[model samples]
Each structure stands twice: as structure tokens, then as C-alpha cells.
Target: MNSWLEVLKPEEIEEIHAASLEVLEDVGVEFQLEEARAAFQAHGARVAGSRVYIPRLLIEQALTAAPERFLLEARNPARSVWIGGGETVFAPPAGCVYVQATGTARRSAVPADYIDLVRLVHQSTHYGTNGGGIVIPEGDFGSDEEKFAWLLLAGHWYSDKPQMGLNLGAKVSRLALDFSRMAFGGRPGCRILGTINPDSPLMFSPEMLASLLIYAREGQGLIVAPCSMAIATSPATLAGTLVVNNAEILAGLTLAQLVRPGTPVVYGNTSTIADMKTMAIALGAPELSLLVLGTAQMARRYRLPSRAGGSLTDAKEPDMQAGLESMLSLLSTVAGGVSIVMHAGGILDSFLTLSYEKLIIDEDTGGMAKRFQRGIEVNRETLALEAIADRGAGGNFLDHEHTLKHFRNEIWRPQLSDREVYQEGRDYQAYTLAKATQAWQKRLEGYSRPVLPEEVEREMLDFYHQRFGSEPVLDV
Candidate 1:
């Protein structure tokens, strides 16, 4: 991870600092709601209509008050994850519709489908960590509350890693907390990945703020994702947009800290742009790649963990375009040293449709990125100068003991993928997509669902029934 090139040098970072200060001073952000305007005004900001001018000193003070690192606790403490100021961590993709294939066809994602995906991810040795409930099924129970319910159910079913809470209204947030309490059997800090969405112009909705407050008071981790679109909703310039986005994140962080000091928060940015001609959000543009890298750097500057948009593609089909775009964004974020990187797969055209095959392909891409982050070996054994001298010119290293000692450690083995000769293909004829599909099927077949105590499951269900007035449907 440290081997990757520094996108911003000291001078560049200084320039960004100056730019941010200028943005705060001159190009102030607007808060359309009067209450938010009054809050900022009361906090020493200069408010003119919807626009609020924040001084650099306040920004610095907020940065100082914010934490540099934190832990995301899980049902089991062994599964808890630490983010910030360390090796880059990879998380599977979040929030997509149909999972795409390498081929043109796509399939709708259901709650059960996401459970299977989670099982497969848990089973895979290659995937770094489990993020959350995979996909929300499109059906009669597609309300935001139901979506949050599904997330809670999925978290209950799986306990291998830190599970993410679904993004929903404040009522759903309370229900999710209830569900977590029931599933985990204890109310531990940082048990769930609490989320809050901030709309553009550096402001969060009241409901979003309320949800974050709930998580903060509980001492759980909070992920604030402000979906800023360049040239339409957010500023066109990258730096300009980053200032507004960073300010919004800082504001949320301040509130969380005020509620509970040292509360875990991840700096998240899904800032993108809409193509002017067609009004379609451009997920594959170079600007997005830049944003992914720059936002990562900004997160580091704030001394907090970062999550950014990824596995994005503009391709209608899961082909070269999809692979290229996803790889570019994924590599940039990983290289930029983002912790808890999100959106690993199942994304297209601003996260509307999810491609299953694309998801599988992204898993493979993530494997490659992880390999890159492992980087080159620097030890004497890796250098192999003595071996080179002893072998003289052109001797076979494959048969040597040194090769035997290191080859397995040096090489990465891939699953659900092939690297065979074409002439030997008839017996091994499956393509990458077909193999991935088969892998998922095999995973589903072999999975053994974790056994929660019957009493605990009943208690969770009873709580849901008490809250929502019905026996909660368990999709697992």
C-alpha cells in the first residue's frame, strides 16, 4: 500500500489547503434550509440568504476536534475492524440493482440473493472483509423500512464480520438498532455500520442527522456519504466540490463527537457528475477517477477513515468498458490509501443496476488490487543475489530449492478464473463469467447457515413485530 505513488506531494497538499481556505472564505456554500442557516449563523458563520461563509479557523478547529482513528465493533470482538492510518482495507460493493454479467444479460437482486452473496464472500479466502446486506429485492416489501429490516435480518444471519446497517428513515434507524441489540445479544459500541446521506450544498436532511445522532449516542460507527454531482448539484471544479463535501463531513463529525466523543466516523464521498447532453450521471469519467483519488487524500488530511464510490461503469454490458472503468477507480482508491473502501461490485450508471457477473468480475479485480497493495518484496531471499551467482548464466531456477522456498509465497493463485492454454480448453471450457456463476452456485450449495439460539431469534422477531405490527419476514 505504501508502494503506491503519492498523488499529492507536500506542495500539492499545501495548495489544496489554500484552495479549501479560499473556498471557505470566498466561494461559500449554501444552506437552503433556514434552520441550518441559523445554526451556522449562531456558530459564528456569516449567513447571507442560503449561503454560509465559514472561516478557516473554524475548519481547523473542527479538524482538531475530529478523531484520527477508530474501531468498528462486530457481534464478535474478533471480527471488529480498525480503520484509518494503516494498510488499505477492501470491502465488497454496496447498493446496486441487477447484478450484471460479462455477457449482456442482467438479473434482479433480491434479499435472499444478497444473503447468498454474503455467504460466498464469507467463504472466500480472497475477499478482505464483509461489508453488509448485499442487495434489496425489488418487490412489495421494497419500502425503505423493509430494506432496513432486510439489512438487520441479513446481519443476524451472518456473524463472520462487521455488518452494515441499511440507509433508511429515522424510524427505521431505531428499528435497526433494536435488531442489532437482539442479534448481537449485547449493545456494544461500533456494532453496525450506521449510514447518513448528505445532499449537496453541504447540508444533511433532518432525518439523516437524526439517524447519525442515534448511532453517535450509541458509540457505533457512522459513514456519512454525501452524493455530490459535479457541474449540476456540486461545484464543477474538483477542489471546489471537495471543499463543500469535506465541510459537510466535518459538520457531521462535529455533531457525532459532541454527542459522544471519540465516536467512530468514516469520511465518505460519492461525488460524481451528470453528463450535460443526456442528463445521465457519468460514473466512468476521468473526473470521477480524480475525485476518488483526491477524496482519499482529503480523508487522510482530516485524519479519519475514508470510503468512496467504486466498481463504477458506464458500459451497458459487462465488457471491457466495465472492467476498465471499475479497475481504474478501484486501483486509484486503493493506491490513494483509502480505508474501508466500499462499492466493490454491482454498480453501473450511478449505482442504479447491479450486474452479478460484474460483481464476480469485480471480486476478481479486487483480488488483483489486493495483490498490488501487498507490493514487492525487499528481503535478501527475494533479492536472490547469491542464487543468481551460484546458478551462473541461464540455469533453471524452477528446479532449485530457493524457488521451492519462495514461489508459493511470491505468486498469487486465483479462484473462479482460468489461465489455461486455448488448445487445452475443451476439458476446461468455462469462461470467467460462467465460472463465477458456477462458483456462486457451489457456494450457496455448500453454505451452512450460522445457528443462532432459537430464543435469540424469537426475541429479535418479537421486537420487530412489536415495532412494525407483524412477524418480520426472514428472507434468509
Candidate 2:
């Protein structure tokens, strides 16, 4: 792999790490869960009510205990993905309650839309793992439990790829593990990947800590992410925000290690600058990429897999703004060597809406980014000295055997981009929208839901009925 993109110098990284340690040792982090506070107190941390001042020794121990990488297994073994070890895995977007299609008004996503989005990820050539909470459906289930059940069940039924776990709380986390075991059958290894976000400004909510502890004790992969909006949840300056972000993540990592040593933990950062006017986190800002770069550097320093960046945009539509912003963030992610890329596709309108057209467009963008990450292979074969000799100056090699043999793998062909000469017709944006719409429609039409065992499907259906007491939403 090419050299990673670095925003922080080596000395600057040490300064940030030292500052974060100081913050953890002084200001400390608040843990709302009693269990978390007790664990910290037992582990030589100073516990004051809900706040725990973690010592540098504890942080070092946790960093040493956490594994650098792990494997996430899928029902279909071929679809399994490696979470770390210099791997860059693209997962779909999560937590979007609204969805938009080309030429359609933004509105609450329904059950059918969720199913369709799952199918899109299942058919995608770029996305690897089907991230949980792909969309929070409206009027679909009666409660969070029912909604989570549908999301997990439909994700399994529609896609056999590796999946991330639901981190809503303890109940949902347990539900994810139970469902995974029902499908994969008493697996000893990690079958689900999960991410827990610490509430910004150095705080961990009870529900998040509960999920973190549950996942850690169960030996599931956990990502401790802190989304600190600069000047809002964290300090105004980017460097100050990094200090806060690192401290919160370190606290969570130490807690995970206390619960279960050698747990797979990814240092995650979704921090960015807040829109000065609205005070909302701006996903499209260039500073977002800088934070991802800095976060990756910090994760490398700790020798852990890092998760950050995505095909992010704040555009209301999949237009020029969306394209530019998404590409900028995604390219930075791949260049920075983020191991697990969250929100890689389908997000829009400051992550409030998931656009179907943008899903297809971002797939192409991700493909391009991964291709760029691969860089150039300059071996004997690729050197093409023999081809140059075979085809003298001014000679054509288009029909050569070497050209025919390597073109497909050597060239990154785009699925959505039109490379032909332009013609007078609809505008570029209109053309792109039409193409993306057709692409998703084709994928849905051609999609075949992955088949599950009869016993497993029946067991899941029984559990659904017993738990939710409602008919399962199995339509795709």
C-alpha cells in the first residue's frame, strides 16, 4: 500500500496523545453507568460519582490488551470480511430515518424502503459489510425492539455478507448476539461488528456503556467512537477537539479491556466542525477529512484498527455538491488508510436522509477510491517493457494478447459514469440521476434474497412472533 496521508506530524501526534492523557488524568470522563464506574474504580481509576479519572497506566494496559485486528464471519463463508490488518472495509450508512429518491421529496423511510436499501447493499460490488440501522423505518414496528428485530432479520435474509451489530442499548445488543447465534449457530468467534459512541464533551451514556460492556464480554468487535462537533460538543479549535475525542475514546477502550482483555476494538472518530450558523455538525466540511487523517494517525500509534470517514455529504440532493463532498471525504478516508469505513454510502442532508440515487453514485465513488488506494503495481509484467518492444514506435497494441489479458483487471471500469462523448440532451445532473435510478432499479429487480435454512428461518420467525407478537415484515 502507498504511504498513508498524514495531517499531524510525528511530534504533533505525541503532543495530542500527551494532552489527551492529561485530560483523562485531570478533567476525566463521566460514565453514567454504575457498572462502568465500578469497573474503572476497581482498575485503579479515581471514581467520583459518575466521573472517572483514568490513569495513564490503565490506558497503557488497555491499549496493550486490545487486539489490532479480528475477523467478522458471514453466513456464507465467502462473504466474510476481515476487520483489521491493513484492510479497508466499506460498510453502508446507518441511523438515517428519512430517504429520498430521484425526483422525490424527502420523507420518512418505510419498511419497503429499508428492504430495498438492504438489497442495494447486497448487490453492491463496493460495500462489504451491511452496517446496522441502515434506516430507521417509520410506521413499521410498534417499538424499538420490533424495529431492531426487523432490521437484523431483514439484513440477514436479504444479504449474507458480514454485518455490524445494533448498538442502540443493552437489549438491542443482546438481540443482535442472539440473532447471530440463531443464524450462525453457537459461534465462538465474532459474528457481528458493533460501534458504541460516547456522548460528546467527555461523557458516556448508560445505554452506550451497557452496550459496550455487553459486546465486549460477549467477545464481539467494538468500535469506540466519539463524534465531537467542534465549538459545540467540544472545544472550538480542531486540536483541542482532538484532545477531547482521544480522551473519551481512551476511556471507553480502557473500560472494554477491563471487561474482557484482548477484545477487538477500533478507535473511531466522526468528529467535525459545527456549522457556525445552525450549530449542527457539518459532514461536508474539509475539516472532516483532516480529522479522519489525524484519527487514523492516532489509531496507528495505538496499533489498532481505525474507523472513520465515508462518502459523506450535506447536500439535500445528489447533485454537484453531493458528488464533490462525497468524493472529498471518501478519498481522504481511503488515503488515510481507515480500516472500517462507516457511512460509506447513501447518506445525505447532513445524515438526516439516505438517498437511493446517491447509494449507486457512491458505489462508483468507492470503487474509484479503492482503485486509487491500490496504487500502481510496477512489477515485471506491469512494466510492459516486452509489450513496448513487441509494438514498436507508432504501432498499435490494442489487439495484442497482453493488452487483452490485462485490460479488465488493470482498468477500473465505472458502472454509473458515462465515459462516451457528450451529446445534446438532458443536463449532466439529470442524466446522472436517471442513470443512478435505473441502476438501483435494475439491482432490485435482479436481486435474489440469500436463502436461509428452513429451521433457522422458522426459529427466527418464532422468536419474532414471541417477542414482538406481530407479523414479520419479510417483503423485499
Candidate 3:
């Protein structure tokens, strides 16, 4: 394949690494959890209260011990996903609390919305990683315990694809592990993956650390991301923000290694720029793609799998702006060699809302990105010298067997984008919106919930009931 995309020189990457090491050694990172701090201290890091000064030796050791790639098992064996190497896996939008449709005002999402989102994910052809907790229905769900349980159970009920583990806290995270064991059995390797974020500006929060420790000890895959907004939580300059981002990620990665060596950790980045005047984060900005490229390069420098990019946008609705921003972000993501793509679809309003239309549109965008990542084949048959000679210069090759045999594999067909000539009455944007709306509704109409084995379903329910006192409701 082609070399893909890059945003930094080798020397620049080295500069970032050296600067990060200096920060870890001198400035230090705060590990809010005592266990995390203790783990760092035992691994030769200097500790003062919550601040842990991780030395270069520990960082290097951690880098050496961390695996480059790992497999995540799914309820269906065929749906298992490998989360590294040159592969790019797309996940749905996360943490959105509102739902929006075209020409309608956004509103608080309910449990029904969450379940439908899961169903959309289950039906999507492009989204490979099923990220549970795609949208949190805080307005409807009574308690954190109930909400987290519903998210986990809903994912099991709707999708057999590989699901992301919960990381809200140690308790919920451990519950996610229990569910994974119950559903997928006690097989080796990572059964599910959890996402953990640093507090940015050189800190790890207590809840995040608690979940991180649990995931590390249990040998589950972890994505250590730093979602610092430039000029707000981080430095105004991209390079400066990168220094802070790299440091925080390294600190978390080191802690995970200290807790358990050979842990599968994806170097993750959701860091983006804040509009200077308003101070609001802009996920759609070109700077986000630059950050994605830089983050992926940094991860590659350490020989680690990386996570970045998505169909991210600042648009409130699934309109033109959403499509433009989503394509740019996703294209850069695939070109930059991102392994796990979070928020790959169904996001709108700077992640405040999840739009069903965008999910369908972004899948087409993702298909295009994947096709581009495949690059072009140039050897003998692909060069088409025989086909050219068969047709000669003036005549067309439409009837040639070579054209017939090659076109299907060589061309990428979009599911949503129309290739036909526009009729006189059709409006392109309106057509897309109509098509996407129809598409998602049709999917939900035809959706069939995957059936878990009877005993496994009973065990998962029993575990849920034991953890949360009330009898759980499965119907959404």
C-alpha cells in the first residue's frame, strides 16, 4: 500500500518524545488514585503525594512491554475484531445526550433512542467496532447503576459485533468484565475494550484511574486518550498541545504496564482546537485532522496501535456542513492510519446530539475512505496493457472481458451517494436527507435482535439482577 498520510518529520516525532520524557521526569503527572500512584512508585517512578514523576526508564520499559496489537472477542466468533496492525475499525458516536432529526428541534434522548442507536449500529455495514454507551439517556434513566446496566445489556441484545467495555467507574467497569465473561466465555485475550481519558493538563482523574487499574489487571484492552482542547485545557499552539497530550497518554500507558505487562493499549487522541473568540471546541476544524495525523505518528513511533479520527462535526443538523466535516475527518483518519476510529458516525452539534441520518451518510463516507486507503494496484494486469492492446487507441474497451472482470473489485460503490444524473426537479441535499431518513427507518423496521445462547442470557441477567437489586427490563 501507499505510505498513507503523515503530519510530522521523524525528527519532529523524536522531539516530541524527548520533550514528553522531560515532562514525565520533571513536571510529572498526577495519578489521582492511590493504587495508580503506588503502582508507579513501585516501578521506579518518583512519587510526591498524587504527582508521580515517571522516569524515562519506566516509560521505555512500559513501551517495550505493551503489545502492538490484540484481539477483542465478540458474542459471535465471526464478528471478533483485531484492534491493531494496519486495520481501521470504525465505532459509533459516544456520550451524546440529545437526539436530532432533519428539520426538527433536538431533544433529550430517551432509552428508546439509545436502543435504536444500538440497532442502527447493529445494522450498519461500515461500523466495525460496536461502542456501547453510544448515547446516554440520563434524562430518562433513574440511576447510574441502571443506566450503565442498560447500556451493557442493550449492546448484548442488539449487536453480536465486538463491543467496547464500560469505564464509568471501577464498579461499572468490573460489571462490564463480568458481562463479557458471561457472554463470550472465559477465553484468553481481551474480551472487551474500555476507554480511559486523562484529566488533561497533566492529571488523571480518580474514576478513570480506578477503571484503568481494573482493566489493566484483568488484561482487557484499554484506550488511553487525552481529549484536551487547545488554548483551553492545553497550549494554544498545536505542537505545545501535543507535548501535553503525549505526556498524559504516556503516563497512563506506563501505569497500565506497571500494573500488568503486555497489556493491549491503544495510544488515543481526541484532542482538538477551541475557537479562540468563543472558546468552544471545534471537532470539524482541519486542525483536528492535523492532530489525528500527529497522534497516529507518535503512536507508531512507540510501535503501538493508535486510535483517532471520526465522522466528527460541529453542525447541529445532518446538513451540508455535517457531510463536509465528516468526510474530511474520516478521510484523514484512514489516511493517517488510525486503528480504532471513535465517533465514526451519528454525531452532530459538536457531539451534543446524535442524528440517525448522519449515521447512514457517514457509512458511505467511511466506505469511500476505506477504498482510498486501499490505494491503487500497478502490476501487470492492473496496468491494463493487454486490455489496451485488445481495444486499441480509438475503440472503447466497454465490451472487453478485462473490463468486465476488473470493474467490480476495482471500483467502490457508495450506499448513499447517488451517481445517476440529477433529474430536473431533484434537490441534492434534500434528496440525501430524505434518502438517509428512509434508510435508517427501513433498517430499524427490518432489524432483528441477535439471540444469545439461552444459558448465557440467563447468566447475564442473573449477574445484572445481583448487581442491581431490581429485576431488569430487557424490552426497550
Candidate 4:
């Protein structure tokens, strides 16, 4: 395993842990659902109204019970990813309502756009899973259920990689699971991942709890993330924000363990300070690097897999601002040793929209980060003193065996980025944009549908009707 980079010392993590425990025992966390409240009360916690005062002992127990690493079983077992053990996995942009496509203004995405994005992700070399990659709320389907069913069919049909499950609360979540079952011939596997986010300011909504319980009971991979906004929901200071974020993660992880011990739940967070003047969430601020590094330390303390940060930016388009900010966030994430990174591509405008050009650029960014994570090998073969001795001083080793054998693995390359020098006083930005646009079109037009068996495809459609009741038939 590659060595992990750290920003906080042991004492700092301890201080954060102690402060988080104090917050849990004093201020308490609110659970809107009766079942979640009851579960907390049943365990050793005191309940007052919707708030639950959890003791430090209960948190320690949950941390002890949770596994350090687990397999997210894929339909193709070879593609399965192991989360934890200093390993990192990445996914594309997910749950965004709008897309800023090439040569067009921002608009609500449709089904075809969603499918094309999935195909692109399936073809990308960098991403390990297509985790809830697109969120097209206003699709061609009549109902949300119908739209979701078709989306699942398309994702499962286009990619054999592991994927993310939907977050449509409890009742609708079942439809996605059933569809996945049909996709893989009724196998009870944990390929689909789900997320449980606490409504910030120490609260978890009823709908969030319902989905958490459903996904936990169904034996799926769960990400316990809290979207904490500093100075608005959390405290103004970064350390203070960590206390609030850690508490939410602990509460969610405890709930998952209580539902079913040994369940694969990831310790996750996306907390950042809000802009003081405008009060908007600052997703691309430089301070986010610290948050990502802190999340890694806390996850290590609990011995659970962690996730955060990505090719993220607050820029409106794929420009230089987007490039700098996304790289800053991404390098921090990779260095922090996050197990699974969400929104690692295509996110823009503080995550309100996705951009196709940015997606391509982010894939390239992820490739660079992955290569960095490999670190440098220092064995005798890599040392190559023999080759050095054979070549002598002032002699070029470009034709030597050592250089020939190692160059490919030793050097990094780019796909979307260009190496040609632009003439002075030329419009380089336009050239970049035009190149990205051409690349995006080339990939989408060249995509071919994967071979999902006829029986399986038919079963998938039948399963949709068997679950959705056929009121809104899919047009695709």
C-alpha cells in the first residue's frame, strides 16, 4: 500500500475526537424519524424530543464493530473495489440537476444526456465505478419512478462496473434494488452503493433515515456524509466544523451497525465554510484541502473507510479558474488517502451543474492523481546501477534495457491536455475549449452499447413493471 499523507498530528485527532464526543453528549443530534430515535434510546442514549445524547462508549463500540475494509462486490467480480487499506477509488459527477453542455447554456438534463454521460464514464480509464453519475430530474418519463427505472436500465446496460444506488428515500429505493437484481440474475450482491446525509445543524430528516435503514437492511454499501456549511450550520472555525461533521458521521455509522453489524459503511463528509459576505457555500475555497486532510485522520482513528473532495470547483464553466481549483481539491483528496471519492469529475458552480468539457478534463486530472498515489518504487531493479555502470558518465541511456523496460510505467501521460506551444498573442482559451468540444463529441458518437443478454434485458423490463405497476411505461 502507498504511504498516506497527513495534515494533523495524533494529538490534534485526539482533540477533535474529544470535542466531538463533548458535542454529542451536550448539544446532542436530532433524529426526525421515530425509528431512529427509538434505536438510539434503546441503545444507551438519552432522548429528549428529537435530540439524542449519545455517550462516548457507544461510539467506541460502533467503531470497534465496523470492519476496517470490505469489498464492494461488482457484477463482474474482477472489477470489484476494496475500500480501506489505504486504497482510493473515484467516481464521476452525481446528483447534479443541470448540465452546461458544449455550445449551449445551462439547462435541465434529459434521459439521452444522462445515458451518454454514463457511456462516457463506462469508457473512461480513470473511474472505478459509475456511482450515481447523473441526476436528470426532468426526463422524458412521466413519473420519477419511471424515469429512475429507465436510468437504472441504461446504467446497468452500458457499464459492467460497480455503481451507486439511488437516494430516493425508502419506498422508491426498493425499485432500484429490484432492477439491479434483474440486471444480474437475482444475485444478492453489494454492487450498488448508497449515501445517508444528515440535514446540517445537528439534524437528520425522516426521509434520510428511511433511506438509510432500507439500504442498510438490504446489505448495500453506505456512505455516511454530512453536508455541513461552516458559519451557517457548523461553527466558523475549521476545527469546530470538524466536531460537528464527525458527530454526524458517528451517529449515521452507529445506526448502520445497529441495523446490521458488518455492514460496509464509509465515513464521509463534504463540510466547508460559507462565504461570510454572501452566505453561499464555498466549495472551491483553499480551506477545503484542510477539511479533506482532517476527514482522513478521523477515518483512520475510527478504522473505517473515508471519502471526500474531488475535481470540484465553483466556477461557472471549464476555464482556468476551474482548472486550478479542481486540481487543488483533487490533489488534497488523493494525498489524504480517501477510500472512495465522489463528484471527482464534471462538477461546477459549487456542484449545482455538471459540464461535459470539465468532465473530460477531470478524468485527466484523476489520472495524474492516481499516478502520484503510486509514489516511487526504490528496489534494485528501479535503481538500475548496472545500466548506469554500462552507460558511464556523459553517455545517454535512452537506448538501454533499463530505460526501455521502465519508461512506460515510470512516466505519466495526458489525453485531453495538449503539449503544443500556442503562438504569442493567440487565443489559447478558445483553442482549449474547441479541442475539448471536439473530444467530447468524438467519444459520445463513437460509443457502442454493451452486450446485455436478451433474457436479462427482458427480465429487467418485466421487473420494472412488476415493481412500478406499469402506469408509466418507459419510452426507451
Off by over 4 Å in 4: 131-133, 421-426, 466-476
Model 4: per-residue Cα lDDT over 1-476, one tens digit each: 35677888999999999998998999999999999989888888999999999998888888888889888766677888888888888888788889887679999877667777888888777778873647665755657767776777777878787878777777667766776677677777686888888988778988789988888887778899988888999888888889889999998888888887777889999888899889998888977888998999899998999989988888998888999999999988998899989998899999889898888888789888888878889998988999999999998999998999999999998876778876888677877777777877898788777677799978886766776676333333
Per-residue accuracy of model 1 over 40-91 as CA lDDT, tens digit each: 5766778887677777766676667666777766665676677776666566
User: What does the lDDT come to for candidate 1?
Assistant: 0.70
Of models 3 and 4, which has the larger TM-score?
Answer: 3
lDDT of each: 0.70, 0.90, 0.88, 0.83
What is candidate 2's lDDT per residue for 1-476, written digit by digit as tens?
55888999999999999999999999999899999999989878999988899999999999999988888888888988887788799999999999999888999988898888888898787889984789988865789788888888888877888888998888999999888888886667888999889999999998999999999998889999999899899998989999999999999999999999998899999999999999888999999999999999999999999999999999989888999999999999999999999899888998899999888889889999988988898889988889999998998989988899899988999888988898987588788889999999998889887888899999989988999888796863
- Better-scoring candidate (TM-score), 1 or 2: 2
Candidate 3 deviant stretches above 4 angstroms: 139-142
The TM-scores, one per candidate, come to 0.88, 0.98, 0.97, 0.95
Candidate 1: residue 138 Cα off by (Å): 2.3
For candidate 2, give the lDDT of residue 98: 97
Instruction: Report the error of model 1 at residue 408, Å.
Output: 2.4
